[model samples]
Target: MKKNILNIQGVSEISKAKQSEINGGAGWGFGGIDLSKCGCDCAGRVTGPLYCQNYFGCLQVYTCNDSQES
Candidate 1:
């Protein structure tokens, strides 16, 4: 079970787009998380503000690649 952690905090839009590309290329689509499959329970979204009183929050995505054993 290999884990990939994606941080969408202060990165540029291009970087974020690249992340989406990587996920989509891997067959995860725009939603990214595919919890329907076995061993995909680790896939989820994490979100929180960067600071107090801030409206915008960053996101962190947790995904698993079970194709290869760890």
Candidate 2:
């Protein structure tokens, strides 16, 4: 018997409005962890700050600053 494997990859550009929502927009919306705090130039970097882990569990931020160990 033989098994087959599939490899797939693609890129899609997102508008600023959408990115804002994903990055956690302000107000009563589901948005937190400002990417700016990470001090990373996502546009110039190949891999931007993708995710982070803190005492509150995994979070979506450019960087994780949970210095104090829990």
Candidate 3:
């Protein structure tokens, strides 16, 4: 783990982070996780600003078509 210095309010502190990879198996190499969409509904009510499906289900953050903006 290396050291990171943060200056807040003119105060300096050190923070350490673990090495990127431990054994090179699913390590912090693929930019963490990329869960596009679990197809879970949020605030299930309005299908306007909110996304849902009368046939399928609630199209969530990474599920609904980004171009289909209300």
Candidate 4:
């Protein structure tokens, strides 16, 4: 049997994020979560725009799994 696995990391710099879509309401507006950037080709999930304080304003984490066996 043979198996293959790979790990990769990258930093995506975005000029601006898409504005959150808010539903009309009387008080607070319920809206979708905001992201700097996100997408995955494999079985995976997007984790964060976990806030940061300085020049790097936020982080978006993508964890993916693509494997094959023979």
TM-scores, in order shown? Answer: 0.15, 0.21, 0.15, 0.15
Using TM-score as the measure, the top candidate is 2
RMSD of 1: 20.5
Choose 2 or 3, whichever is better by lDDT: 2
Instruction: Name the runs in model 2 displaced over 4 angstroms.
Output: 1-8, 24-70
Clash pairs, candidate 2, are 24-31
| lDDT (Cα, 0-100) at 26 in candidate 2 | 41
Top-scoring candidate (lDDT)? 2
lDDT of 1: 0.37
Pairs clashing within candidate 1: none
CA error at residue 35 for candidate 1, angstroms: 7.5
Ranking by lDDT: 2, 1, 3, 4
| Count of clashing residue pairs in every prediction | 0, 1, 0, 0
Please give the distance, in angstroms, between residue 28's alpha carbon in candidate 1 and its true position after superposition. Answer: 15
Those runs of model 3 whose alpha carbons end farther than 4 Å from true positions after fitting are 1-18, 23-33, 42-70
- Expressed as tens digits, the lDDT of each residue in 18-70 for candidate 2 is 88787444434446645444433323222323432221232234444547678
